[model samples]
Target: MNATSGAPVNAPAELHDRPIGDLIRDARNLSAAEVEKVLSYQREHGVRFGEAAITLGLASPDDVLNALAQQFHYPLANAERRLASPELVTLLQPFSVQAEAIRAVRSQVTMRLGQGEAARQALAVISPASGDGKTYFAANLAVSLAQLGGRTLIIDADLRGPRQHEVFKVSNSAGLSTLLSGRAENQLIQTVEGVSGLFVLPCGPIPPNPLELIERPAFALLIRELSTKFDHVVIDTAAASLGADACVVAARCGAALVLTRKNENKISALQDLVASLAGSSAQLLGAVVNEF
Candidate 1:
């Protein structure tokens, strides 16, 4: 419930101040009698209404969460009943604590990417090594940006090891690789259903030469074209310490953020990756220490 602090200012005043129980009742997820049971349990156990509802088996956890989301005017995950995981919390559970943190990152990214005469419209999310959580951060950040009512696009440019298509639940049959290979048309982009102003471009099939594809001038053109069409373009790239693909993508995008998992990534490798990005003509937008 503390996550309500990040609610959009344009949200209704009542939504901002409504009690959790009232919101749950308005959502109609529980009958009046069930709500009364929850309230009685909450009063006796000093637990939140959502928790009480779940504890008493009146509603599943996902149901309670969806009710809370409806109460707070946050976007729910999918119409298919799939719950959002902690990794993609921003899309499904926009009023969660994790989503709030992602919104904070979005705020910093917006200001940094929008600065200067020629704004840096594209951002490549990179990490020093694999398992550093760059893709997770990039996906959630894109969702957060889209929640602001601006057109936002997230591209899975990490050719060899793609995840955006899976995360966004879109097809990866044709995307960046196919687009760059001239095998796919502009149809490579897919709208994230249930999420307004949010789109995804998956990595498609893994190419034999990811570096060659990324280094081509066509890659820059693709980024430029995407930038013009979307208010924000967030690209997820490979680990810099693993290969030169991320650096190449970051160089083309012109703005990059390094993601590192606490107590997992090597400091020396991070230093070397940052130095490499600096040499690649990519502006470093500060590093993020993700606890995930």
Candidate 2:
């Protein structure tokens, strides 16, 4: 008898289109009897399969979530690798909670500018301070946009503490800094290794004067050229409090996403950062509370 339907289940058909209970059972996370118990509770109370499994204490929240992801055909990330905070969710585990959060952020950003418009070109990801995870959010957001089939470029504009080059695992030998100084031309922008439709413009050599480099007119030209080349360009900026770099970049990008961390971030610091951005030409798309 079928564990979910209580009918004789066909193996091939069940493999393709089984109910959540059967899918969870097939994952071998729960025994057949346990699955039947969960199904019984689900049918009686009209609760979701994952919720029912969690309520009955048959599965941990993550186990039920993995089972649910299996049912929906969304692949999970490889847990062994040392992927950065947001990289796993955006690149490998599109079905996970973290990935969903990134997507929600994407939707909010899109809604602000309306998708497929020139106004949506570049977005600078900024934060009140360093620990707010702005770089992680920017990297993941760019990957999510690429997953939507747009040609997306992530610029490591945080020259003071550049990370996108390391995040994408590419060489930072020649990028935005070199381009601005006329050391390199269009050849520096490199396509990210694994992700399709995703490119990275790493902050080249750490300059002695980071703010002076961004103030150049060539910096504005670089953004203008990238806007024409990519469907979306995401700039990772330095923490707003550290220096004027983020505000300068944001002013040129014309839009920004502010990231805040729970319990770890200070409200007064965030307010000060917001005050600074108020003077920039960039529109504040929205704020994201990153739990990770």
Candidate 3:
């Protein structure tokens, strides 16, 4: 007789709605060796008796595996496991220079952090004006932090015109705004696959008042929470002189990585930004002069 023809016909039906473990325990008459083989097959290909159960309208294999993975902190393979896009990886390779820059900045912050203080530090990347490699610097800095064995989180806080998700070719359907609105945390946060220890919180849908949103208590709380979770929190703020959002972020950030192109107009803007932040509490960690 077939496997199903021999069982108490309604037995599988009763266990159908039960948990996978319960179903496994109650489905008697199946030998221990046979049960182990079924389990092994399931683990290797995510199929076998579980799928048969579901196919026969008994239980859901997907849900069971998901629950078990979540309960055990099992690292499930996801889109992030795919290798970084060739073009994007090539573009970021030059950022090896930024790795050194970040080390220097990290030293300064470490000295300032002293003992007994929380290691929650924030860093912002700002430029004299647009198109000065600020985002590139920020992205590279994040990668650098991950390379150093730190859990790094990069936030595209440029609400006015966010680009982090686009640069990484990821979805921006949900992010900081969704989190601020009290949505599920997993929905807004995504781990950058392939790059171990690097996470990104894309600037979801841009709101009308980017400055107002950044200044909200929710924003501060989010930053604090994220800082605690990651070893490094790098925020890509808008150009310092071009938007109010940048200034607000600058005021809250522990340090600012100023970017200035090697040019007269940009240098002038950088000078102005330096003067503007000179008296402010935000530490001017250092500046990066981007060539072309």
Candidate 4:
């Protein structure tokens, strides 16, 4: 699905409309004889087919969940296939409290981003320091935004210590840094597997002059181009203290969300960063405090 347009997702055939029994059978590779047993047990116990399958150990919980996800059009990763962190609450447990909170943040951000202007393309996720859950929050926010249906692109601009490639389980052999450095010509952005309408521009290989690259006029051109191509853009940046990278990124995007973590971030640093943003061209959308 192109999040930039109203196009429908490139979803698989409508399997969710099928009966749970059929979904369960296909999901678990159950034979006709095994399906009969599940049906028999379901009737005998007055339980759903999925429940009966689970009770009989014919299908694991993950199997049931996989079938259910198909039935609901919910984007879910197969437990056997996911390589990202469990803390990716938005994708792993979309209904969990954490995911819900991310959705809430998305709502707030979306409400603010409604516009007919080009600045609507990207939202910079920034912080005063590292290890403040900026990448975590940025990754989840991108996923949550993608869940809204259209395409959402999260650009890993953290050239100093990039990690969105790992968070989204994508190859970082050629990405943002490489593209900015004039080396990448193809596969600059990869469509995330399993998550529809989500794309990633990984930080690519670490560059020698990260700030110099971001400061180049090409960076501004890139932001403008990306804004036009994607429905929503989320750019993750190095901490403000690392340099003016975050500030520059936020300025280019025209909006930013500042993040802080409990016990790790110095209040004075956050105050300084916020103050700095207040004086910049970018609008300070809001601040989020991440605990644990």
Question: What Cα-based lDDT does every candidate model obtain?
Answer: 0.81, 0.78, 0.65, 0.86
Worst 10 residues of 4 by lDDT: 1-10
Ranking by TM-score: 4, 1, 2, 3
Q: Highest lDDT: which candidate?
A: 4
Estimate, for each residue in 1-292, the C-alpha lDDT of model 3 and write its tens digit: 0011256655544323455554443433346665566566667777656564454444455444533433343323332422443323312332344445555655665565543334566787887777777776677667656655657888999877788897666789887766656663565666776555778888888777777778888887777777777778889987765676776687677667677876634556777887777766677766767664
The digit string of per-residue lDDT tens for model 2 on 166-200 reads 77777898888887777885577777655657788
Over 1-292, each residue of candidate 4 has an lDDT whose tens digit, in order, gives: 2334354688655777888788888877899999999999988989999999999999988778878877877788766435556657887877788888899999999887776774365899999888899999999999888877777899999999999988887899989888888997776788888888889989999998999999999999999988887889999999988998998899888899999998889999999998887767898889988876
Model 3 TM: 0.63
Q: Clashes in each model (backbone N, CA, C under 3 Å)?
A: 0, 0, 1, 2
**Top candidate (TM-score):** 4
Better model by lDDT: candidate 3 vs candidate 4: 4
- Candidate 4 Cα errors over 4 Å, as ranges: 1-12, 43-46, 115-119
Worst 10 residues of 1 by lDDT: 1-10
Scored against the true structure, residue 112 in model 3 reaches a CA lDDT of: 57
The C-alpha TM-scores of every prediction are: 0.76, 0.71, 0.63, 0.88
Candidate with better TM-score, 2 vs 3? 2
